[model samples]
Target chain A: MVFARARRPRALYLAYYFPPSRASGVYRARATANYLARRDWDVTVFACPMDFLDKVIGSKDEELLGTLDPRIRIERPPLNQYVWQRDARDFGPLRRTFPHTAQKGYAWTQRRLFPEHYASWSFASVRRALALHMRRRFDVVVATGNPFSSFAAAWLFRRITGVPYVLDYRDSWTLNQFTDELARPEGDPVHTWERRVTGGAAEVVFVNEAMRAWHAERHPHAADRMTVVPNAWDADLLDLPPLDLSVPAAPRPIRFTFLGTVTAVQPVEEMLSAFRMVRRHADFSDAELHIHGHLGFFKGADAALRGRLQSDADDGRDSGVRLCGPVPKTEVADVYRESDVLVFLTGGARYVTSGKIFEYMATGRPIVSVHGPGIAAEEVLDGYPLWFNANSLDPSALADTMISAAKAARDLSPEEHLSARRHADTYERDVVLAPFETRLRTLARRSS
Target chain B: MTLVDEAAKDTPGTEGTPPHVVILSYADPVPQRVLAYALYLLRRGVPVDLVTPTAPSSPTSATFPHFRVWEMKSVEERHPVKWLQYTVVHRLPSGVLNRVRRVARRVPGGGPVLRAERLARRTHRRVADLVDRRLFWPVYDHVRPLVLARASRRALASIDFDAVDRVVFTDTPAEHLAWKLAQRHPETVVDGRLDREPYAHLEQIR
Candidate 1:
């Protein structure tokens, strides 16, 4: 007699950021969801609806949804906080003052009620999760977060169904990594929620070692259960051919390129100051500092950085410090191929590693590190052959490093050229997550 | 159908008396409705006074027949003597008059430098006329609200309600002038045919 194999245990993955939303954290969430579904697990994903991510965040990558596995069931329950807009027509019972304090007050109310600080996700998600669980009970749940409210949903599901659950911290919550401060004051709702959620979890996963160490130091008893799963180079972008590196027939100037987002933390002032110093030198005359990135992460935020850059450009400090704004994903490789040298700037230290570092390494372009030396990304870029560390924030030191990188980029040997692409080949995203997948399978078996 | 003619027929005009009527309005856009009303009153044997904000010789007022046009020709006292004094002083040439004017100033008797004053008034009138000609009427209308309020106040202050049998306001803004006439001389008829923009609710009379 031919006997059928036992049915696989089901898993519910809760991620506020998933496919079709081009949030910074979406890639990590997408990789987790897609990897599990492909590994023969029944993956049901609860996420922020497509329409909500588009209107509020103003970014949507509908094309990325094509990359998702068809087997996964992604349910987008109505998120209640989304209904309450920070708008004038809807400001009920609040006086309309000149400097409107209503928006801040509304944000404060969410932080008081939920650990996620600005969510009503639990309101709709818990009800939806309960109905789904009653139909077919999930064996194990893994909740990933930035809107830590998703943690509350998974926690409630586990309590109701008596199923074991795991947690994935894509970014820190209740802990501001840049300043390394305990993000909230004592007795806040976040403090109580964090303690309760961590106490009940089967396992906790962090994206970087610095974050895990911070969490471990804060709550040592749960330290043994935590594992680090750092973000890696996008597999899709890895195979693109390197620049031909032909000397331009009539190159306008040497382009010291910085591609990606120009955030508040990326040290824009230091980069600009350093570029001005490098352009002052006779050898680097007619140098154009090309910055190809979105001015900020969100739409409205771009105006401030745009204005500052424009004002300085108008002042004529450096003749051609161009802010060549965001390029399409298809054009990103072309932007890399065009530049002589690359600038890698980050605002995070120890705990923060930007995903751009992997792509930067893959270009084999001499990268002048504009970020502080202590950032977690330093460890990744340290071994690359063409790397130039701007050891201090001083413009002169950065200028010296930038000049050396531009010169090296202009005159590259074939062996030295192969080094950048060679070092980055090892950290493909799928390779980074392979061990994490095995660990997840082990967790599922132990629970069953 | 004319109110003035019908009234004249019922209560015959006395030999020594003429039925007095006054019409107040802005001179801009010719105030065609107000002019038509005044023309009807004149045809019915009523003496009409048309108050022109600028010089009375302005073409809008001059075009009307059988009506008196009163203009405040100088920024002087409203009484008759100041108008007399203003006209008498400005009739002379200013080249020699300036020397005499400086002497009069030192002697504490410079009576407001009417020549210079008249020059300023003439300059203002010319500029106002140029503005009315060149600017789009709506663009020129920016100052009309304040001008409308002032015109209403000036008409109320200077007109004698006892002499005039009725006050006719053909524009909306002159509603204030009608109210004042009603308050000061209850016997005088106060009538404004147009709807006021500011007191639009009052115009909601069905």
Candidate 2:
């Protein structure tokens, strides 16, 4: 007599930006997928097409694709590139012949359907999921979104298949995190879509408590299932060496490093101003402020940023500022090691908790925040022994904080370093994700 | 020799080295950010050509040394109807009115003729403005992309598109030109974003 083998519980993850597409939210999606796969669940990811990654965004880190767990399956759904298509040659016959009429039709589709350019992709995702479901049933679905189309796709798939799904809010849909205002005004279809998607979700996950609270106020019915799963530093990517108890205790030029993609929203000008001001002091006379990352995510933004960084004094000959350019993900550990102090430059207040702070804290190095007061990241950095919050964006105040951070970097005690490292240890990818994974497992088992 | 050749001859160091990237800005008021990106490319040892409808008025040739600026108006000039509409329609009437004024001064008791000439010129100006607003502009708005496509094609003839590394669409209007270029050289990288990271990958592959 033959006995049927027990099947592993399956999860279908809908993420518009996944591996090889170097968008900011990919890291969280990658970690979530990898975590699920490791926990003995069969995971499949639905992501954006290669053409969108190659031609539309022109930003891809192929090295990241190699790091994905082999057990996780990835599917690319085609996006109707009517809005993003810059090359006229690729347009359809209708668009080519009657451009104005085609635009009207496209706009009508956006208004009638899911109000996003990726709405077609969401519909395509649902169709793809339904087809796959017919062959072999998926126990649960998990969708992470910036395109929020994925959330709508999951909702559609659940309605059709009666499958339970989780909504991972890597970003906000209606609330503008930067200005703390409504991203879309009243009567916008996006508000309706968000309401329906949240109302139906089996579980809703947010990156921080502030975001969770904001969404909970709007979605009180789903508030019980809503949980905060803060973004944690990936151990596999960093591969940081065991912390050394012995301090360097050497008198040398401090390397104040700011490592991340520089964007317009960040206080880059203020950071530069503070760095230059600190350089005038006797203790920081030879200190160098090294900016190591891509200038901006958007094409042509780097030029404006570079122009902004250009100094008036003899083209910054003696400014002690260095543009170290972008370091690959694999080599990021070395950058963290070489830095004496880390500059946590970011934008957004209460609702924003940047992913870089985890990596910065994990290094056990002194961190100096250059953002506005009351940033949600302060919640994580609250108890970190070496954290030096400027508390304001004023350049003079930030310069004073930088001086203190530099002193701490040079004379930090081994006990304090170990304490900071221990604080960061709690936020490790596996550590922070353990509860979320258990919840998924329980949901899958209950559904089965 | 084409305008590209003349531009290369003017810049001594860039005679043989063709532009690695072509940036198209089809809007009248080109964004300063786009110009900054072009400047950034030049600083990074990358050759650049800027094609635009209206060049910046800040002495860009002196500021952005070795940068090539190809005016889209030059292409519009090649079309006789557009030339008549742009140059002759506005200028010829004004010049004739001025000449009538000059001749009227030489004639004895020419006040009535001068008044009549002024009235005729005013009527002509009003009629010309009405025609341009109602007919010419609306037609041009629809046909501008097609005309600019030809201008971009003409501009590309000077450069080796096969060797060109990137074709960036700086704004919405430039998408038409980008589409045309993509059709001709499907293998080339035609994109909207002029990101520096992808070129690093290209360099690695090389």
Q: Rate the local accuracy (lDDT) of all candidates.
A: 0.69, 0.83
Candidate 2 reaches a DockQ of: 0.12
After TM-score superposition, what is the CA distance of residue A396 in candidate 1 from its true location, in Å? Answer: 1.2
For model 1, how does the per-residue alpha-carbon lDDT over A1-448 read when each residue is reduced to its tens digit? 9999976768888888887777778878887778888788889888896657665666676767877889989998776442323222221333122112334455565766674533566557777877887887677888888878778777887787777788899889878878878788877888788878887888888887888888888777788888888777776744567656464435457888888878877778888888888888897878888888677766456656765666566653545677776676657788887788889888867788887888888788899998776888877887899999877778889999999998998787767878777888777778888898887777777777
Clashing pairs in 1: none
- Could you give the TM-score of chain B for each candidate, in order? 0.44, 0.71
Identify the runs in model 2 with alpha carbons over 4 angstroms from their true place: A1-3, A245-251, A312-316, B1-206
Instruction: Give the Å shift of residue A61 in candidate 1.
Output: 2.4
lDDT for position B74 in model 1? 33
Kindly report which residue stretches of model 1 are placed more than 4 angstroms away from their true locations once superposed.
Answer: A5-9, A82-84, A88-112, A242-252, A316-318, B1-206
Give the per-residue lDDT of model 2 (tens digit) for B1-206. Answer: 00112222433224454448888887777788787777666665566778887777853667656567777776766776677786666778888899999999889999999999999899989988988999887766555666677766767788777767678877655666677787788876677765564333122210
lDDT of 2 by residue, A284-335 (tens): 8899988888778754466677756654335636677787777888889999
Q: Candidate 1 chain B: worst 10 consecutive residues by lDDT?
A: B197-206
**DockQ of every predicted complex:** 0.01, 0.12
Best candidate, TM-score: 2
- Reference-based TM-score of each model: 0.63, 0.75
